[model samples]
Target: MFTPQGPTLRELAAQALSSVEHGYDLLAPKFDHTPFRTPDSVLDAVGGALRPMGPFESGLDLCCGTGAGMDVLAMLCDESVTGVDISAGMLAVGRERLRADGPPSGIGERGPSVAWVRGDARALPFGPAFDLVVSFGAFGHFLPRELPGLFAQVHSVLRPGGRFVFPITAPPRPSSPWYWALLGFDAVMRVRNALWRPPFVMYYRAFRLGDVQRELAWAGFAVELRALPEFGYRRDGSPRCRMVVATRGGGATPV
Candidate 1:
């Protein structure tokens, strides 16, 4: 699951015992080495899917954990890119990485000017300022009940006609070993959360694609799902993964 540089079992146990912010802070330095970091392949696939919708002016990466989505935003947005997260330690690590190999500091030089802001996704610090917003691999941290507020926050931050995009893979078939693995994982998390204080909230099965699309619609966004060809199709011929592109609009669109 983790590289040698990633957190050890004891370290992971310690993190799980702490609050979500604190757990992430403790794991921030070694986050990219862990499986929890969004894979570069998914980011590349999403970048390809977004290329047609862009040449966007400004972009935001909500709940960016170590800033992987910023690279995608830089490729699509011409003006500026901002990554927001709740963990200051994670932001600090991201800042160090950006300073090491980030885009040009000057806006409109070569790539988009990038900035990292520490804040919560539920109550964003910005207004309708971004033309494109992307999030990767962070939804599992948010419970099902929190979907409406989270969707509303994303809707509020995006400029009129702007897009809110994210990649969501199909749930594993019940017959597959992966399905039982995830079920066991979620069950263990539930037990842990029940017994633990300052609960470390994370679940693999809570963010259902159907429920998410409906919540996005209720939040005043026109939603569309685009199949990503990179992962190919499942046995049923449906896309293995789809990019949900929600646009801020007055009327609803097909999901």
Candidate 2:
């Protein structure tokens, strides 16, 4: 669901028809008003979970749309924070927002200096320059096959023992309404891509936890899952949402 300031039906239609980058570019102005943006509650929970792991140095927000994840990075990292995204329009909006309000003044005068770079996640431009990396709600854009390269890139950019952290929710059961809703959405996307050029690669059901963990292991990360107790657990005693913390090993081996 979108707010009054969010994209209109026609605008949504136009965006859905375009390529992911172009669609996000068109939607950037109103992205924060839409449900698509990561919620503040999840952000707060992640910040709380990561705070104990700090105080880190340089941090990176992978696929950082409008720099929402940067807020979490700012609280944890002391030196600096960088947000890398592929959409110039999204980066422009993020830059303007940060300039207008500025980062919170909590961590002293330097205040975790923020920088935005336009780049792809599959091929990060930086070296082993970051101590921590965080991404929020951006995984659907990459297909299952692309996980290896994506995780490898993240591994490449993080320093030894650095982490790539993100929250993942357990998929709803087949009997749940949310399951049917997501299935319908994916079906429509499949039909749209079948008939259209420059296919958009967002599919809700594509990113499986088992597959993801395996890929992260293949990419030289020691994977671990910590329960986010704030979201509570399922009837089977499994966590509804868990933060996946994949730590890069100190060894200089290629994944």
Candidate 2 lDDT over residue span 1-255, tens digit each: 788999999998899989999999999999999999999989989989989988999999999999899888888888889999999999999999988886665445867777899999988999999999999999999989999989999999999999999999999999899999999999999999999988987899898999999999999999999999999999999999999999999976365
Off by over 4 Å in 1: 104-108, 250-255
Against the unseen true structure, what C-alpha lDDT does each candidate score?
0.89, 0.92
Q: What is the lDDT for 99 in model 1?
A: 77
Q: How far is 169's C-alpha from truth in model 2 (Å)?
A: 0.2
Clashing pairs in 1: none
Error of 2 at 253 (Å): 5.1
Q: Candidate 2: deviation at residue 11, Å?
A: 0.6
Q: Candidate 2, residue 39: CA error in Å?
A: 0.4
Query: TM-scores of the models, in the given order?
Result: 0.95, 0.97
Q: What is candidate 2's CA lDDT for residue 166?
A: 97
